[model samples]
Target: MKILVIVPAFNEEEGLVKVAEQFHGINDVDVLIINDCSKDATSEVGRKLGFNVIDLPCNLGIGGAVQTGYKYAYDNGYDIAIQVDGDGQHNPAYIKDLIKPIKEGRADLVIGSRYLKKEGFQSTFLRRVGINYFSNLIYLLQKKRITDPTSGFRACNRRVIELFSARYPNDYPEPESIVYLLRNNYKTEEVPVVMNERFGGESSINSFKSIYYMIKVTLAIVIDNMRKIGLT
Candidate 1:
């Protein structure tokens, strides 16, 4: 199977080199770095690392960056595509586990969950609470247990690629994507994985931004879900 590892980057120069190198050695995996018009040298670093770099002319948020990757995967005829954060948060070792379910045809979408096995770097209380709340909301909507809905480290097959490429959320689409998959009768599962702290740079979401993000994303989830159910 042709597996493309899509790394969406934005001002992540400090970690991009290491991130690209780590995944380069993986078998049957081709790395594609989508440079989201980062102010840093993210694109140069990725190019130096010899990754298939897609440089965006302007800054697209995380969601836009990720959707660009999905589009490439679809257009390039890749059998599977995996989303890995440009930040140092996602571990590359757990990628095999994430791909297993899809290879077995047991799942079409696989997410790497930090809270699954009680292992990994614990998130801040506020972040954890927000993740859990959204996860539960997804569960309630799909009638299936989802431990992590906002995990960026995930794998999706061709079907999912086609679906997401056609219509994906613009801002913080993770939770809403779960509903999309579930409603389309696609299988989604989470794999246990560890996450590392950011090596450099501050998170884009601060305390105030976090609260605003939560409200905005929650409303998007509701509206998207309602549209899916033909209740709009």
Candidate 2:
């Protein structure tokens, strides 16, 4: 199958080159970097590494950047698309694991879960709490347990690509996307994977921003659920 690895980047110049290099020699996988109008040399680094780089004219946040990559994958006839963070947090070795279920036609979407199987790194306490809360909420909504709703390291087949390309959440869409897949009756699963800490560059969301993000994302999920149930 043709696997398109979409790396959504925003000011990820420090790690973009290395990240692209790691995927350069991988078989059956083509890397595409969506440079979200970064102020740094993200696009330049991607080009230097000989990657298929799509430079957006403006910053579109994480959700828009990712959707742009999905649109490209869908238009180009890619059978599978994997979302790999450009921040060096995601390990490319687990790419096969993420695609296994989809390739077997057992799942439409696969998430790389950090909490699966008591191994390697764990998220911050506060972040873990938030993850559990959202996971439970999605379980209640979909009647299926989801352990990792915020994992960006995921793989999807053409069906998911078409869905997100048509309509996707603008900000912090990971949680909401889970709902989207569940609502449409698409099979979703999480595979165990390790995530490294950011290798460089400051995080976009600090403590205050994280708190605000949590509140905003929670409300968005609630509203989306209501809409899905024909209550809103």
Candidate 3:
């Protein structure tokens, strides 16, 4: 199966270089960097490294940047598309493991979970609290246990690529997209993988943004669940 690694970058030139290094000479895998109109040298760095780069005319946040990758994957006929953050938190070493269930047809979406093994960089206490909150919320709504619902490290097959290309949430998409897939009866699974601290660049989410993220994602999940229930 043809695989594409979609890295949604925003001013990640420093970290992106390290992330790109892991993909070097990996056979049967292609990398695409979606430069989200970063003020930094992300685009130039991607071009310099010879990876496929798509520069959005304006900043569209992570959701829009990732959707752009899905569209590219669908149009280019990729069998699997994996989302690895440009911040260098996600490890490329686990890319094969991530795509395994998808390639075997066991799942349509596979999330690389940091909590399953409970190893590596386990995020901050407050952040883990938020992640667990979403996990429970999703289970309450869908009865499925997604250990790390907010994990951006995930892989999806062609079907999901097409679906996301056509319609994806605009913000905090990882958890919400899982709910959408489950509500519609798509198979989703999680695997044990280790995540690392960012190689460079500050996180977009601060204390203030963390509070907003929690509220916004919670509302998004509830509303999506209600909409799905209404449709059913």
Candidate 4:
């Protein structure tokens, strides 16, 4: 039951060391930092902390970086893979619970949701509104509701790792990937978990960028749904 926690890092120098340190103590879990060609010293910080790091040649966005980790997990025969953001928004203390369902053969994907009971790190109003919009969009197509469609903290078993390794959504992937998973009949479960604010650094998406992000992801999800129905 080897577990690989893939940390996608981009310009997250402040949290790199702490994030690695927090997870290093987990039993049977190893940390792999996929540096998305960060402008800051994210890779160097990982190297200095003696953590495994993969430096991408160029920025592949969150989805590509995570796909790299899934590929590594698949090729290296990891039993499970978990995506942990390098920004430290996710707490490692919940790692055991997140992986429990997967370890017990209950689910293929287990997402840590912040809005399960509306507890912990609710994010800003606009972000919450955006998350709700995506949630509704997903429900419209899949007939299932996701409390936190934008949650980056998630775990998946070997089957999902293999599938995602071959293909995955690139830009703004969290929500779109869910559509892909459900469309393919993969089991996805959500667990309510309290998340923390980022350890440091600002978000890549701002108010202005979020508008474009919303439109792009909405289109992506619809297009994915179309593909599932052979409409595309």
Looking at model 1, residue 68 earns an lDDT score of 94
lDDT of 4 at 185: 92
The positional error of residue 202 in candidate 2, measured at the CA in angstroms, is: 2.4
Model 1: CA > 4 A from native: none
Kindly report which residue stretches of model 3 are placed more than 4 angstroms away from their true locations once superposed: none
lDDT of 2 by residue, 1-232 (tens): 8889999998898887568656756878988999989999988888887888999998899999999999999999999999998888888999989999998999999999988884666767777877888899898887888888888899999999988888888877899889878887899999999888776665665677667777898887778778877998
Give Cα distance to truth, residue 5, candidate 2, Å. Answer: 0.6
Tens digits of per-residue lDDT for model 1, 1-232? 8889888888888887668656756767888999989888888888887888999999888888889999999999999999988877887888889999999999999999988886867788888988899988887777888888888889999999988778888777788788878877899999899888776555667788878888998887777778777999
Q: Name the top lDDT candidate.
A: 3
Which 10-residue span in candidate 2 carries the lowest summed lDDT?
198-207
By TM-score, the better pick of 2 and 4 is 4
Cand. 4 Cα-lDDT: 0.89
Off by over 4 Å in 2: none
Candidate 1 minimal-lDDT segment of 10 residues? 197-206
Clashing pairs for model 1 are none
lDDT of each: 0.85, 0.86, 0.91, 0.89
Q: Total clashing residue pairs per candidate?
A: 0, 0, 0, 0
User: Measured by C-alpha RMSD in angstroms, how accurate is candidate 1?
Assistant: 1.4
